[model samples]
Target: MASTLTRLGAGILSKFGRSVASPTRLQSRPYYLYSPEPFHPIPDKQPLCMTADEAVTVVTSGMRIFVHGCAATPIPLLDALARYGKEAKLHNVELIHIHTEGPGILAQPEYDGIFRCNNLFIGANCREAVNAGRADFTPIFLSEIPNLFRRKIWQLDIALIQVSPPDNHGFCTLGPSVDCTRAAIQNAKYIIALVNPNMPRTFGDGVIHMSHCDVVVTGTDPLPVISQHCCSEEEEQIGRLISENLVQDGATLQMGIGSIPDAVLSKLYGHRDLGVHSEMFSDGIIDLVNKGAITNAKKTIQTGKIVSSFAFGSKKLYNFMNNNPSVVFNDVAFVNNTAVICQNPKVTALNSCIEIDLTGQVISDSIGTKMYSGVGGQVDFIRGAALGLDGLGKPILAMQSQTHKGSSKIVPFLKQGGGVVTTRAHVHYLVTEYGIAYMFGKNLRQRAYELIKIAHPKHRECLEKAAFDRLKVMPCP
Candidate 1:
């Protein structure tokens, strides 16, 4: 058996123009054979397990460090870095990541000079820092973030990641957040992993051999959980309309976390063979999979598998994903690629917006100039779904007709300085509790009329007058 395995390892290395000295049996379990690249041999030296503070000493001044984001964020490492930076008076230590949860101690005012943040996606923790000019926000699609590292546009010196413990084959999984962290792990000069037993061992592109990690710190804290909230009456109504009208059987779905998406998923219990190819998902998807509602039977891409880049929800969701081969966690670049997403049949991309103008302009990431969130994979999936195979797919934008303050979300014009995450041309289906409006290829005047019809009852009259005045057309009967 040892001789046979040595031959197999040698054959893989030879194909990559590399050689290993006497392939030793590193672990009992077989190496995963899915990734296209050849698996490098495990190092002879065992990984040094240490405390968070000791492992973080590898991070030096002026280094660009990548932090794993979302549910898989390495909190212990981040906290240690914060303490070390302040004590050592470290300067110009740049931290980069997508949206992360928790208090974000590094982004606090006291760490202004010691630790600087370059956020790819602004979450609640970093919003104040970005607005206060203590940190910076990068407006880019989630699909393009991996390329930024792979192409060496933003070279990373170190990567702080949280991962599952090494399986028998000496392989550790990145757990919930494969996303950009896969690229960071591959490209970064050094890797410091927080080995947490609580993290689910998800399969696919997130799996990495422990030989890749330079240092490992034990962390057993519970993974952060974002509970599902009940949708309001209006949101429930809109969700029902979308599930009934737009979502068809065998449709591939891409949706974010929120009450509206949860409401939509709840209503899809009766739908057949639904597939998910989303950037991120929450607990709602687990129910659908268990009920056999999402068989992925008719998907054109990765058929029979639920593909996602990351996940965050209740502990039940993580437990559902633990060592589950049915759910394949991949990098965001592959999951959110326009070309890849378009391959799936009936690709329905459901996204939300902060506000939208009468002419179909979407404001999602920011309210006027203030950055509320990041320009995520909304455009990528929208454009991909719009061009679905044989034109069977649809991109739906669903939001409440009005804010909690009773202000209209559908306006005559977007607030001044608002960022248009989705342009007029990319918007296809717009939904509110009032009804659905198809806006693609419609003239400005026609769009205004269609949008006003779906506005809240109290705001329709004022919206119509503003539309008529701006569009210079007679009010529709």
Candidate 2:
């Protein structure tokens, strides 16, 4: 201990005060002990700043670049890249990111081979491009994305990120996004950051020193904001079924963004001490915090803090995260780890799917052969909750009984080429506006009966007939 402290730089020793520093893990918190308090390390030198156009000048053809994603997307840099690419006639400049929000021109026909996008998870901005074959999507678990960069599988030449201004000690936070961007910086040859004062300074594994940036672009662009989703009557009914029946007090939650998620969270105000350990979150959680429903007191890990990899929401939600100690943003790799997720009690992973077959096969990422979205972190949290520490976890899949076109979502067979994001074995609880179905340990015939019970009333007869044909036994409900 004496030798380790002797090796410590005077700056860290002085700033850290009485906090013990372990040599094995030289961070704000020791390996054995961790708190949600924000920490900053002093830097010996500050990095120089440059204009957005000048920063992209380092890009050469055939270089793969990683763009920061979610609400933390660097809008100005991306816009500048598009302009500079056309001007310089740059070709084969591959861009990688997950669910970014900005000018969607990179994948347009005009840019074409100049700037090609490879989305780890498709968002609205690039969905059309991916489907059109102008852009590409990689279907992988969100938890393993970091390995793609770190292990040099998808070697990155440059990393573009958005961050808050450097603190007094010259440390800037990665703002709302940490996930794979952190790993990108760790391995990328060049690191470019857009310093946006409007980006919220969040805590957890996102802090970086300005000295680490190869080039910095200063901008004050406001982060993109998504308004709250209003739930439909059917969505509201689905929410009530999950919230009232499955969501218990002291449960840890993992959910995505949508009317179904919004509906579920809307009804969680009556619960007590509910915890959040999700890959990402949106404005829906803000109300639960306001209503005193999400106190995080009952969580066995990271007690008293809402844990997430990133967030995307309205200005109100961003304000709630700025320098807020109660919220701890972490790396998506750790946040979605089944081992970490199952450490908590009653982890309810509330999710939605595009469709489900009678035998419990789920299709979420595609409509038949055409890709609609990338496979996100659904399987991670689903398996995590299925193995919850206290033995009462719920892995639930919820959706409306019928598609927007009035077709039954519960079918006897998945679409001819539909991608199954979650398989039959991983499934446990399935919810719909009509009711809930528990599928764990059930045979094919039994699972079909439960699913038909919760399917739309108009489609039940057809589903029943289809089930008997498939199961070779009468599926009576």
**lDDT of every model, 2 decimals:** 0.85, 0.84
How many angstroms is residue 396 displaced in model 1 relative to the true structure, after the best TM-score fit? 0.5
lDDT of 2 by residue, 1-477 (tens): 112212322232234332221222222213112322223332343344567876777777788889999999998998889998989788999999998997677878899989999999988889888989999999999999999976779878788999887766567899888887888777676677898889999999999876666567778888999865578999999999999999999899998888999999989988999999999888889989999999999898799999999998888888999999999998889999999999998999998999999989999898988788778899999999998888989999999999899999999999998999999999999999999999999989899999999999999999999988888998754
Best by lDDT: 1
As a TM-score, model 1 comes out at 0.91
Off by over 4 Å in 2: 1-45
Q: Give me the candidate number with maximum TM-score.
A: 1
What clash count goes with each model? 0, 0
State TM-scores per candidate.
0.91, 0.91
Per-residue lDDT value at 365 in model 2: 90
Model 1 has a clash total of 0
- Alpha-carbon deviation at 384 in model 1, angstroms: 0.9
Can you list the residue pairs that collide in candidate 2?
A: none
